[model samples]
Target chain A: MDGTPGGLSGISAPGRVAAPDEGVTEQELALAARNHGLPLEALRYDVTPPGLHYVLTHYDIPATDADGWRLTVGGRVRRTLDLDLDALRARPATTRRVTLECAGNGRARLTPRPVSQPWLVEAVGTAEWTGVPLAALLAEAGIADDAVEAVFTGADHGVERGVEQDYRRSLPLSTAADPARDVLVAYEMNGAPLPPQHGSPLRLVVPGWYGMAHVKWLRDITLTATPYTGFQQSVAYRLRQSAEDVGEPVTLIAPRALMVPPGFPDFMSRTRVVRPGPVPLAGRAWSGHGPVTRVEVSENDGATWTEAELVPDPAHPWAWTAWRTTWTATPGLRRLTVRATDAAGNAQPLVAEETWNRGGFASNLVQRVEVLCTTEATAA
Target chain B: MDGTPGGLSGISAPGRVAAPDEGVTEQELALAARNHGLPLEALRYDVTPPGLHYVLTHYDIPATDADGWRLTVGGRVRRTLDLDLDALRARPATTRRVTLECAGNGRARLTPRPVSQPWLVEAVGTAEWTGVPLAALLAEAGIADDAVEAVFTGADHGVERGVEQDYRRSLPLSTAADPARDVLVAYEMNGAPLPPQHGSPLRLVVPGWYGMAHVKWLRDITLTATPYTGFQQSVAYRLRQSAEDVGEPVTLIAPRALMVPPGFPDFMSRTRVVRPGPVPLAGRAWSGHGPVTRVEVSENDGATWTEAELVPDPAHPWAWTAWRTTWTATPGLRRLTVRATDAAGNAQPLVAEETWNRGGFASNLVQRVEVLCTTEATAA
Candidate 1:
């Protein structure tokens, strides 16, 4: 496993400087230097820390070094075209605090789990990816429906026949124009030139999709009537079902993220002996789909349940929703259960999946905790 | 963010030595001293590790030096269970590797997310937990089938009116005897004396459920036809339908822990350049369910697709299934898609989830990937 050493853990850096993105005076290099496990040192107060900022590179960093960074568009287009860095930047630009997660971010958790770069959950983080939208670029190219897909190519190299590798990904023209997808051919990382570890020079930023689609070192673009079958396209980033059907197996999704809710601090099925006094049952709940509505705590394992008061935070939609409810801790073993409801009022499930795969990709079963009993009086 | 040492992260030990559980040697420690990342340094290679050892203390370790401990179980059983450590250990023992995961392990990832511990996928792990099965203990106690829920309590203290705390959770009787739901009153972890952090002395271990129900510091066992209404259960771990649902909020389940097959890499749109050499696609897949039977790969997103070779393990029903595929790298943007079919032929959903909770629980979408263009020469 390539343990890419970049956790917010044990690491040091130079002095602090002002960050262009959040208007915070923090040194970008130092912010990115915090080793894994310790996010506070680098993450500081920057809403979008420059160094710790996320970068979705296509392949490795580019070799162009910006001498002639350019983008080209062709095939079934009203206007075949090419644009340099200056011309690209001349176009309109926008940014938002979207979280970018490598599709393989948590893959390590799987047992007999293949080793990759040792990334903890921190591999997934929020960043203000800024760039010109692909739709605007497509408009410039005057894309057509016959062109079923818009292929993105990067300066990154992969050894095909042991030669140059140009990482690429294709999207449906429909998706390319959705505008809601917010796909971007980006050139900046948190208001700075992209770092080498991140995609340097230029890259594409496909929001809401796994990090793979945000090709790094972007260098080429093409429109195709049929889907492009590249190495990555034909192979990587896919999830398989446990069993197959008549002809072939099924294909999985775009991208999805999960969150924690109430019944959190105290996982389900835990046993605890309450200390004599009034205690609070609290937890946090949130979702990638939308905002959370309420979170419930049940000490009865789902028989009789209660609602915990949720702390409101409009600014924390992408963050966690904290909830609290007080309870009287009586003697003897006690059981607790917590669950959450989203703004859509969707609740969490209660069963572990019965499906099996070679790698445990998305194991989102009901979380359970086991606590035991004891009181202060037992000390005597 | 009192950090209160914080979720499973800040937990550490003094490196003190003590008699570990059965089969565990002082040199062998499984659970990590720092992170739950595997191949724990504290271990020296034994069936069980000393540090990763399980614990089920009847009292909170914070209130006292706590060497001598006592546990008591009462209610609905032929014989009430009350005894010190020695007496409890004297009971019959059984061993098994049950995966224990916190419902909040992936909690921090949700948007509009809740405030809770920052648990990574590592929040869940499998161990050869050794103990007297809670079923066996209950059998000895003469459990009553009329019992609705089997509630458990722990010694960890939760804030009470803004103070310290004790953690707790409970389970349904159906869940209690589920062969799939293996609950243990464990005295050994990985085959050694329980660590102080994990439940020590004796704790209730319920497999396949959220962590809360597997109460640590277990001192009591109560089987009641009517459930217990503690703070954790009534208010936490409950799932409501989407807020948009037109019915009264329901609390069925937000079952987590789904797995994808390994070598199940996702590929999205490919590039425009056609390359003529063989390229490889790889990934892994697994789920909380059963084993995988098929994994399909599509070079054209969901259009024309091909079946990849499936590889699986024999030992674990819960382990991931690894897979790989080979294809021609034609230069062009590629759309790579992969999905799994379980033993029952349950395919990975193209859009596994239609509903998302505020807590962002249960998100199982299809997997996709994109690749770049390669020339025949490069591919060759």
Candidate 2:
């Protein structure tokens, strides 16, 4: 970890633009090795298999004993409660198919490249999460009237940007107590006990929010009269313009669409090669702001757009909408792109640089795929 | 994918040393996003969970309809048989826990870097695979005396180095027909149907060999009188000293040991930090040559070594052996390394550069990790 030169100095530092020649730093590679994203082709599945779902862990997955694990709820509560797995399982369970995306999904595409996780557009996935509604637990614990925020603490402890702490995030008291929000203390993913990587035993599932708010290995929840100013909440995951100015906190995911890359990919360049004919292009689209209302495709890099058929799953409103279209590819190089507009009217930026920020949060740039159509017969 | 500057020209060109100032190219990042490696901390589990297992797909995960899929065994056989899922499932099934490591496992660690998948040491995982033995299938088809090799073809198709073709590889007739080898036409992984990324429906699982021999999405098996010289076989996955050197063909896995990186990691650098005390460290080790006979740990970067206790699972002979040791931590920084030796007398090289090759295949260099021990109380 020493003297291996590539990018900036130090283990964790404030965000900055990488030098023109600087390749991905070893630190970034280390993070990429531990975490993974959904393979874009996996967009074919409506309920992403747990293994195919994207994962981003801030620290080592803490070894946990499920039977002995307990969730403690205390601060500013009328009655502090400690609940084990069995106790939580005995409560009514709710399941929802939800899409989760990392706030830094398109960070690598940013021109200067935020010196963090160098993500492309693959950092999103959809899974069915099952657990007891968090609102029920708060009611049982009897939140105090003076409580203004609820801070959820996870068992995963680590350092980020030089600050050592347990991973923690807070929600406004109103949002935490709202039954319509449908937040859950998730214990299962895709019908099985959560795998260790997905936070075995228990975790938090905040619908329609970026992954940071859905803390894995959840251990405790504390209600506070004042805002929780932890590093994760106050410093990281924020959309900042520069070093001095405080930026807006990244929350709901912006609308975005990514296609299952057409044809087969070249092992190295990932340039798609398709036979000269009608190629069916399909993809998944989603938004945290609201349901995706329209999805459009462009074969000439967004010069002209055509609407695709949208098929939204009513049973899983929080999950992504499946869209499909057809293109008659000719013998030439083509750059294909896709974008989504939510019911709330927010659309993805045309390019990653449009949404660039120091922390590289929520840059839902439209996905562009390069395809070469040839008539030469090949082996298959 | 155009105009993205960083590395060498033209996608899928022959390997070469990257300039010192060159950062990871977008082409490499595309490959990294699609293929993922096992998380080091996941070593805590005996059988890595399906999702945690490392995956390297040569092309897109071909979508297969299990009910309609067929396995065709033809060419130089007494009888060409097309067996469907039901027909194959009716055959006697065998299950075994096997460890699969990519031939290019440590490619990224090499000095020049192969510029392929850019994998670190995490490109390995152990899983329980169940299916009918390949020897039984070959026996049923009745091999011809003149057949020198058995070619396995998969449904995955893509262009590599400008040649478009289906993914295919071949094994010697003797190796394919030897029941003692226990080669399997596997359909299940970790007690469940194979995940799409892992080759759904059916795939080949050859024990003791690198992952290339285990063809995924297997569709056809053709016997031939001559050795198969496909792109993946003759052009790629070969060890070469330079452009002109044909080099030895890569096969068996080399002995290697990787510890579960101790303590919590900083998000970006992954530099581990631990409290000053006795720290218990554990990891998994294995080799294609034979069972790991010994594991040694070095806290001062190989200045001195200490033997660790080895625990091999008798039931899973082809899987990795577990090893553990404890280190007394002082208040400072330390470089820790681990190496393994197999019963076959093969040992890992001390440095990655010692095993460097043009293709970056089978560079099982020793594992090195750095840790910081501090007495200061932190937030967590």
Best by lDDT: 2
Question: Across residues B54-124, which tens digit of lDDT does each residue of candidate 1 receive?
Answer: 22221223322235776666666667877676776788777766545455443323343332332222243
Q: Write the per-residue lDDT of candidate 1 for residues A1-380, one digit (tens) a residue.
A: 01112211101121121122221111111111111211211222224343333332322233356767778889878898888888888989966445555554433233333222223233445555677888888988898768888888766553321223467777777767678767777777667666554565777776555566777777778999898777556543445432131112112211222222112122211123244567755544445445667666665677876777877666433444556777665544455566666655456544333322332233222333333323432110
Q: For residues B70-131, could you state the per-residue lDDT of candidate 2 as single tens digits?
A: 99999989999899989999999999899999998888888877778888899999999999
Model 2 chain A: worst 10 consecutive residues (lDDT sum): A1-10
The parts of candidate 2 lying over 4 Å away from their true place are: A1-11, B1-17
Quality of candidate 2's docking, in CAPRI categories?
medium
Clashing pairs in 2: A23-B23
Candidate 1 chain A lowest-lDDT run of ten: A24-33
Stretches > 4 Å off in candidate 1: A1-380, B1-67, B83-88, B105-123, B160-165, B178-180, B193-198, B201-203, B241-315, B318-355, B366-380
TM-score of chain B of each: 0.61, 0.96
Error of 2 at B309 (Å): 1.3
Error (Å) of candidate 2 at residue B263 is 1.4
